[model samples]
Target: MRRSIPCLCLAAALLAPAAVQARVAQARIARMHTPVATLEQVQVRLDWAEHADSGQLRIRAGRVDAPALGYHFRDLTWTCPLRRTPEDGWQCEGALRGQGVAQRALALRGQGAAPLRLGIHFDVDALTATLAQGQARLALERRTATPDLTTLILTRVPLVWAQALLAQAWEGASFGKGTLDGRLAIVAPAAAPLRVSGPLRLHAAALQNADSSIVGEGLGGDFQLAYVGSAAARVTVAGVLHGGEFLVGSTYVALPPAPVGLHIEADSAGAEGWRLPRIEWRDGDVLAGSGRARLAPDGNVRELELQAHSGDLGPLAPRYLSGWLGVLGLSGVELRGGVDMTTRIEDGALVEVTAVVRDAGLHDPAGRFGFDGLRGDLRYSAEAPVDSQLQWTAGELYGLEFGAAAIPLRSGDGTLRSRAPWRVPMQGGSLTLSDVAIRPAREDAGADIRFGMALEGIDFGRVSKALGLPAFTGVLGGEIPSAHYANDRIDFDGGLTLHLFDGTVRFSELALERPFGTAPSLTADIALKGLDLARLTEVLGFGTITGRLDGSIEGLRLVDWTPVAFDARFASYPAPGVKQRISQRAVQDIGSVGDSSFMASLQGQLIGLFSDFGYRRLGIGCRLENQICTMSGLSGSAGAQDENAFTIVEGSGVPRLDVIGFNRAVDWTTLVQRLLAAGKGEVAPVIE
Candidate 1:
């Protein structure tokens, strides 16, 4: 049985005089609910106070206690002042305050004309939210002062519905100071699992760490999501993101400083977890493909098929990770190729990668460095017992339009082994390397490359030009046919027939050794059949020295790529069929280019001592060691000589000026400069 006594109290307060009405207090609630199934106590308190003169009822406080909802609120207060409007609907200016106030202690001011329209502010703080609904339509708007703050507005939201949202946090995830808004429509009445569909938009969002320190920016998107249950959902988005982007934080990775356009769609019906049928992304000039990425219940991608293609690989370098753009010092590079692969992780690290590529072109301004055809299957499993390796074989490769050749490589267990560094041996040439091995010699060791190569028809002049060396005219009319370099020593046993100095010459037995950490040494015995010394001198940019010059440089050591020591001698041999004339200036110039103190001193002495010295010839022998030229056999040694031991015509000029080792053992720089000056006919007389 229930008794009705609340009418008397209400009537007394309503009929009270104006002076006495100010002392009355009342409490009311427009709506209230207490579900029978809830075990916890639930109560909502709404209090109203009216001012006698203003004729307005203000909601002074509200208390909602729902222990089951993790909500126990106290100190609830609100103020709503009544005002007359032009439409004759009541307008209320109110506020809400509670113990666990988040967002802010809101100042809620609203106007009701059938359906309510409310605007809320967090005191004098920099935040605003507005809500408006009429019949079935609903809307919300929110803004913030923070530049990176995001706003979300939701409409047609069902009071009771279950849904799930999935996101891949490439840089980790944390809730930001962003507003959330979305519209969700329940397809049927609320049940165990409800089907919902809606459009969601998030804008101007920034990503921050857990402590609210900004880590990245420009993250926002609009997407449509459909959910059949808490375990089943689909999301599609189009937006811009900085830093890094990923799919499932594991399957797909697009590293930062390189922007990628993201598009993806997935479902959960096929397997236990989300199954992605297709996902396509374009980053910089690289196109990435992902197909059939099946996820596990624990949000791990179980399987993935992916590929990447690029037309420019310069942007993919490690330096670009730090936003450095000017490091690569080249242009006109074009790359077009793709990798087809699948990957799986074990123990939370990259364990396996199997991929292949074809028709890859790496280019520069000069020309294209590319692969004619590439076919390979590479695999790497860091945790496997054998620790799988990477192997590659290509049909052909072209460098700078020189030609095409095959390249085969095998790498495994921290070692890279190649069958051949260049080309396969053909014709009279045979390539063979014995026990060639290179590895880290010690801790902190850089790369060590040890290989031997043999070649045929390899033009040394062309090699010198390609390697940016001072041009030395050589015989290159025929193939080498037999040249081998092993243990850092190169030996050319075959001859090259060359056209030079208006005559044919043969260069044979040219051997050199350039050991690691040591200078190169060469030895060659030159044979001149009918070499024109005048033309040879002219081609060498020196004054002409006539007659056939026969010479041999034995045990020539060019330490540190510079000629240091050698035993060289050239004689003015009279040709049997031709009578050749030798010039005195040519004699001086050859002596200068040689920078041979012995030659210079001898020339001065012989010229001073002899008048009209014929090929009543001249020859010099020097033993060069420790950069010092030691002259020997100076008196009548193997050439047409004058009647006197050291004379043709005695002039008594400065005692013949025979400088014993003069200017010898000089620094290489001074010697080189002297040689160049002599070649240019700019030689100065020795001061000492």
Candidate 2:
């Protein structure tokens, strides 16, 4: 009885009008059910002549439930007058209104037959949906029991509006506002689950999230999805993103305004949630990858195998991987390389990485390092406890040039170590690397490094040129038993020896902090021995001083390549090769540094008459701290207990000059200025 009323009323409305006594007719359907939808308490009212063929029909106060779609509609009201049609079975025109995110406004028309048929047309803001059905499937178990439906064929529908029908929400991510237009077909079996399949085009679409994990603007693409069943459903997603930025963790990728193609196919993996047999991402001239992935039972990423290639890695770094590099204090650096790599991940962690670089170049504008013509094939894997080999052609670091090298690494026990010692030529010197141990990249503590370095027969002329230091000729050689590069610092355990000025200089307790950051710092202790005084004076433009020189400088610190603090003293060695003599100008310069006048063995009247003088001994010292220089070391100390007066240069023979220093504590700035001016021959005469 409930099933027959819709056909009866539809037939009556389609028939022609006739003259007869007026009567009102109405009936109610307790329930109407489809595989995907259900409507209850449907009321139908008819108002027209009893003898007439056509009448006004109204369906109101109904509710619908589509649990699979997350939709519940209440207060559903439909009012339309059905009339007899010459060619059509039954026709009615009015509105059907419901309260839900799905079809809210729909125009309904139906026909009466063995199986009912209906046309649903929906139109709303920036969206429209139309369904013209040929026939509706009836359930075999209850064909005549009540209103039951099984299948639907949508001839026309808007795709964007269909997104509201899907019950899905991605955590921490969302798509920006836009419209999608296209078509789709929905199939529901009485015994099987519902399925939706089609191609939907995104128009002017965009996406953004709080973490910027998936951000894109002005994006337009087409995506296709087809689902068969929930238990073992195999769904493949294929789409293209027009332009956007994509970042996963610290790895970032960018796209231009042009289209970027992507394809993926996933199949049920029983206990393991899903397995992707094919995956692809393509961006012309930028980046491309092909891969496969697996998901755990809980839908978390389990494993991934990918092969990617990049033509240029320089521009790709700043937009995507800058944050990761910043952890190592390498921000604002430029990187360029033709890169080819294969990465394998297992248990949601990176297990293997293999990469080959072609024509790689990295440049730091701050001038710490810049290298080109670099190439290498580097490999690391958890499976192979050892047996990794890396070969590079050449590189430059800190203005020091180096030759090619091949390094083989062994890995095990949570560390990667060099299988054998490695040696390379750097700036006319050989640098040997041994016992190099590096932590794995995947470890939480960060990939720190520890190694030992030995230098042999390195020429200081080249070193001076590399460091932009003042002219000094020497051979530098040393061995540091241990050096650690971790926590943004490089510290050495042993000393470095330099053969300079026909003598040796030893440096110890060296450390470099934040080598690539602003205000890089270096600290060390230095001991100088047997340096030729005449050559040193000539090279530094400090007038002239005879005899060999020896001294020690302690507590030396350099911030941003400038000496900030140190205690240094140099005295002429007693056993020396050259005659002990001091040029007149040298005395004047020394006088200027000491803030004093010249004292002479000759009478004061004879001092001004000598062009130069012989000196018995010469020494100087300064303890610099807080921009103040405390000076000491004068020949033949003053008999008086005056802190400011000390004899510096002791005269030997006739016309000998004795220099007395009157300032014990002097401003470093003033001393530096006086020394610079004296080197340029700008010192004024000192008369006391």
Using TM-score as the measure, which candidate wins? 2
RMSD of 1: 14.4
Compose the digit string of candidate 1's lDDT tens values, residues 1-688. 0000111122222433432344444445433333101112212222234543323333322344432122434454433433333443223333334454322212111243332333333322232334343331223222234422223346432211101122221222333333334764433222344344566554434343333323433344455655454345554443333444323321223355544556666665434656676667656554444544665545455666665554444444331221211112233344445445665443333445555654554444333233334445455443442222222232211121234344444444434445445554322232333223333212244334445443344343554455554454553444455455554566765665655555655666777665322344666555555577767766566555556765555666666556677775555566776544434444454345344322233455445443222343444455577766544323444221323222111111332322222232345455567557766778633312
Stretches of candidate 1 off by over 4 Å are: 1-118, 121-222, 225-261, 264-279, 282-288, 292-305, 308-332, 337-356, 366-402, 408-457, 473-688
Model 2 spans with C-alpha error above 4 angstroms? 1-169, 174-222, 225-236, 265-277, 294-302, 311-323, 331-337, 359-366, 385-388, 411-415, 564-573, 576-580, 588-608, 614-676
Candidate 1, run of 10 with poorest lDDT: 1-10
The 10 consecutive residues of candidate 2 with the worst lDDT sum are 121-130
lDDT of 2 by residue, 290-364 (tens): 999997644456799999989988766765567677767777778887889998888786777778878888887
Cα displacement (Å) at residue 192, model 2: 5.4
- lDDT, residue 428, candidate 1: 23
